[model samples]
Target chain A: MIMTVTLTILCLLLILCFVTTSIIPTPVGACASLIGGFLLLSFIYGFLGAHFAAVIQIIVYAGAIMVVFVFVVMLLNVPTQDLPKVKISLADILSILLSIPVLILVSIKILNWQAPMIDSQNVEMKDIARKMFIDYLWPFELISFLLLTALVAAITVAHKNKGSRYMLKEGSDHGR
Target chain B: MTIIFSIIVFAMVLIVGFHVAPLMTWVERRQCAFIQRRVGPNRVGIFGFTLFGLGQPIADAVKLLFKEDGNPSYVQPFFYFIAPLIPSVTGLAALMVIPFGAQDTFFGTVFSPQVLSVGAGFLLFFAMSSMSVYGVTLAGWSSNNKYSLLGGLRASAQMISYELGMGLSLIPIVLIYQTLDLQQIVYAQSHSYLFGFLPDWGIFRAPVSFFIFLITIFAETNRLPFDLAEGEAELIAGFLVEYGGMRWSLFFLGEYAMMFAFSGLISCLFLGGYSLPYLTHESLIHIVQPILGSFGSIAVFLIEFATLIVKMSIIMLIFVQVRFTVPRFRYDQLMKLGWVTILPLALINLFVTALVLGYSSFK
Candidate 1:
């Protein structure tokens, strides 16, 4: 109940702020408001007692991310001329129409997730930890290594290609 | 009754949180001023101008309240907003697992204010805190600004690097206690190495864990020297560059709240929490509980809460002091410290702790 109230209040405030200050409003303002709404929703989720999921949501969605999109946008600098002109051919229209049933089916499956057992609660913290560390340790280590590799790749990408058009002749030919 | 009690506890905690957070700000300003040979907020509250600057924090709050909340043009709208909520929510959630004191049965009901008392509660808290990095990272990225992006990248690398060392470092304490319930861990520390009089803190029993834990605590909370995320001089408030008004305030609250939680965890697990010098459990009840009535059982409860606050304040003071005392670590050096130095040391600590615990159990 408290979490719900908090989320409602936060969302309303965020929306009010965005609408008021987004004087030279761009699509970005709307998108940001939507994201903020979800973030507050997750906080509500945390407050409602899904501690593990809430933290995971925060760390993955809010903490280390959202910036990737920003960086991509900045690098792309989507000018009016650069905007990809969509022809909206018949095939695209047909595909969009065909995807409606698939979306509905997915939503139905999601709504039927096993009924949350609010009363039958016996999941011990030690049991969860033992399983997580001992049984899942190998997979966990592998995932972390993968994340590290991703981090390295991201850093490399960010560093490379600065003034690359000129360096192409000097560096690319040598490397090739 | 349970619901009502939980509400009361929640309200008390919120009040305490709000009160302590601004006080910390005052402490930081006054200390910084002292170091620089300047008088701090002395002109505001009680003395100089008679307002005690007691109203400074309030004034700041009002300003934030009235400020025109602005969103940057380049930000990924969705992620930008989610950023602050992530850290703040995770921080508060982490506290659910922390035990306040020992539990006692009263009138056929087990009444313990220590929220969620599970066996692996300590690990759960650590995991929640580890996940808090996302808030800063996402905010930095979503801002669609260079300064913020750099801050986000740095925070990710720093947080992840330190996380490995921090997790490995805490294993030794787990080995010694052989339990994840924080209350049990504190109970284990009530006795001395030689006898009953001396304290049996984790620092004494497992010094390696103590050292690694301390280092990791600094990194985990993004305190001075480790505060690469908001290297204000360099990053311009880091990930929070684009945030304004109340949204910005949430992030600030989250950071301070995390600091308090980290200190509390450290105190509870390793520093004997509220365990007093030369005082037996029996004596505790006799001296303290009488005035409070059956609420005396709640004596340890209050002590645990106060001890946590005091310990956290001391740590925060140190954090502020260090911010003035030392220069910030270069980003690469920070990484090296976590991965190369702290990680290896943590592993060694774990092994040694395991060996000691094994021997003790067998004996």
Candidate 2:
């Protein structure tokens, strides 16, 4: 009964977050709503006994990624732009129609699935660490490599244009 | 009964956390004055009754409470109002998992001084403190001022950069103690002695980590030398430029609360948390039991509690002293210290600690 109540509240919060994200006019507000949604999702993960996953979700996603998003939003300092006029174009209708079947399929699959009962009150970090290093070692290492690749890509993208821009400015000054 | 005791303890923690701001305010004022060769706060009550300006914090609080509460026209109302609250709430929440003294059973109920005795206390602290960046960032953004925006950005970036060093520094501690639970770490420290003389505290085991951790602590709290977020000459109070009255005080309270909490954590981690050198609870009990009979245990508990508080206060004093002694760092210099210097040093410290521990155990 308690679990049912908790899940119900979480579902309500998730819906509220989704609505807020859509309705909020400002970029910062939308980002805040997205963070709220992530937090709620992590709480649900915690409820499902994925304590380590829940914390990683908060730390890596909500804490780090969303912070950068907020930083960029502030940096851009975009004036409040009105929401784009909603038009039910052919593409939108087609996409909505296509999504309905997928949504239904997902819901049906979820309803048919049974979650495994976890008797442990708390998942130990050691257990998670052992599993990460042992059973999931290859996947974990792959993820780290993927993260490193992304970091390098980001640095390259940021650095590539700066040198050329500086060179063009220097050339213009020299010509004058 | 346990619930009631926990409630009491939680209330005490909140009261202490809130009061720390005013107390530290007086301490800072007096200390700064003394360093500058000026008389500080000596006219409030007597010898002018100034109580050495001890009453200054109370005066400041009253002044702040009575001052006009102003909201600027351009500010985003929601974020502006909520921003100050974030730091204080997160600061207090971080304090919940810190065990201040030895666990005791009274009237058939086991009571630990900590409000939340979770297994992952260390990570919880890091997570909450990391979240505090949002408050400063949002405050700066919502103010709709350029200075505030820049301040917020610098603060957030600085915090994020230093957190890497902070976490890496802690790796050696976790590796040594082999537990994330703060209380368990404290217990481990109490049982061992270094070379049969000094307490086998974290500092003794991982001095390099301790040094890196000390630097990160200063950075984490955004104290002097690291207070680029609110550089008065450059940013004009940074994120707090628009805040006034009670709202500004809330941010002030939050910073001091975090300072106290971090000090407690440092004492718990590097110092022999709640234990005097060469004096475990058992040793204390052995000495006091014959003199006081059944009251020895109670005496020991009080002594342990006092020891922890004194240690924390000493750490706080160091924080205040360093704030006055060291000049603020340049923005780029601050970044270099965290990312370039502390980060690599912490990584090397972790590696060396692991190597030494492994070799010793094998031998």
Candidate 3:
């Protein structure tokens, strides 16, 4: 009940912000202010410091990033009816029911597990790096390579049609 | 007293958060105009201070308050609302570790100026910064907009790429000080830089480390030259494209607060937190006590706070100037600088610092 009340209040605050901005003036300030507040909250709680989270939030969420989304929406002109539909199958529902017990068991195990031996704050960068490079090195390297391959593949896909342009130029000489 | 201090700090943060964004807007215009040798905002106040058209920010606030805060019916309303909160909180909370002054005394009880003085403060700071990426990612996904989704993916990739180098760059400093506690690191700098006169600061002992650290800070903070995540001409505000109104303000507050926190960290780490040159803290404490009587501590507190603020302000000024001076990097170039240039140099510095420490320890 308390959680519900808190969530409702949060929703109301968002609504109040939404209504006030929509009713009176320019969208830029309203949007910037609203998003800016959320970004700060995440920075403090989501990460550890306001500095790291806040910078990432602003640049990715408010700065150049949001422009892309807005432009696409404007350009593509997605109408109200064109939205994609999702179908929740009966099998999926049954699988969810089956998974609840497993999830509860996992949570119980985690709850009973020993807390970290070392002071959480005292965990050094070297310890973190040692764990990353020694224990998780294979997975780390695999992910790096995967990312590289994905980048190359994206470029290849984007350029696939352009290859025909160069071949057409060569064919023009044969015709001549 | 802790409660009182906490309330005061919260109020100050709120005021600072509100004022900084508009102040930044003014600074941007004036700096841009100055570079082009044109007058800017001469009509808003006396002596043409125009409060630098300070009213413009107020005008902007009023304008945003009335605009239509629209969201598509298809968008997930819950996630859309929650997304911006993450970044804002993360940004504001980082101020906890920053010691704005040397110390604070409350009702004759001496207390450290910092809110949270944990021994492993720096690690805690990095962890917080890391968690803010979720806000960007969620905002993009929740919007159900293609452009937002793409922007979110790019941001996550960019943040992860730079984060590795950012974390690595600080290793030399930690090794040199033989400590991860920011306060301890600052205290360690109390030694002489040149046998007696120069105050030993991070920059003096490890110039290369300092240079790399400064650059990494710029990349980490996503300030111009390194601001690819928000490359407006290309991405149009990237991941936040769907956000508006007060939600938007939250993101703005987060950014400025983060900037403040970063400058404070740089001050604490490299510049020597509240430590003055050629003056022993003990001597000063001894000399000041007689003149002010019971209020001597308050006088000392004021001096330390002023000194810190001045140092931090100078650093912030440098950031603003750099913002105006530098050109943005291409996405590939930014990646290359982080992985190829920064990472290798950071590793070399770490090895060198470790070897030096080892040699000194044995000798």
N/CA/C clash count, model 2: 2
Which 10-residue span in candidate 2 chain B carries the lowest summed lDDT? Answer: B44-53
Which CAPRI level is candidate 3?
A: incorrect
All candidates' TM-scores?
Answer: 0.72, 0.92, 0.68
- Compared with the true structure, what per-residue lDDT tens digits does model 1 show for residues B1-363? 666666766666566555655667777888888888988876554344545466677666778889998977776777787788877777776766665556654445575657765434576676568667768766876787778877877776777677777777777777777776787787778666666655888878777777787788788777788988889999888877788898998887777777777777888777886666455446677887778877776666677567666776787787788877888898888988888888988888788778867897899
**Tens digit per residue, CA lDDT, model 1, A1-176:** 55455655765675575554344244334334544544665655554455545545545554334434333443333433444454769998999899999989987985564323222134444655787899999998899999999999998887697766465366223210
- Model 2 agreement with the true structure over A77-163: per-residue lDDT tens digits: 766543355567999889989999998998898667554555445668888888899999999999999999999999888787664
Q: lDDT per residue, candidate 3, A47-158, as tens digits?
A: 3323333444555454334444433333333343454554679997999899999989987985575422333344455565787899999999999999999999998887
**Which window of 10 residues has the lowest lDDT sum in candidate 3 chain B?**
B41-50
Q: Best by TM-score, which number? A: 2
Better of 1 and 2 by TM-score: 2
lDDT of 3 at B361: 92
lDDT string for model 3 (B1-363, tens) is: 667776676666556545766666666677777877997754555455656576666666777778788767877676688878877777666766777655546576665766666545576566556556657766776777766766666665666777666777677788788777777777777567787867888888777877886787776666788777667777787767888887777776666667777777877788887666555455556778899877777777667667777787787777778887888888889889888998898888888888988999999
Candidate 1 docks at the CAPRI level of incorrect
DockQ, every prediction = 0.13, 0.40, 0.06
Q: Give the TM-score comparing model 2 with the true structure, all chains together.
A: 0.92
Our model 2 lands, by Cα RMSD against the true structure, at: 3.8
Error of 1 at B138 (Å): 1.9
TM-score, A chain, model 2: 0.75
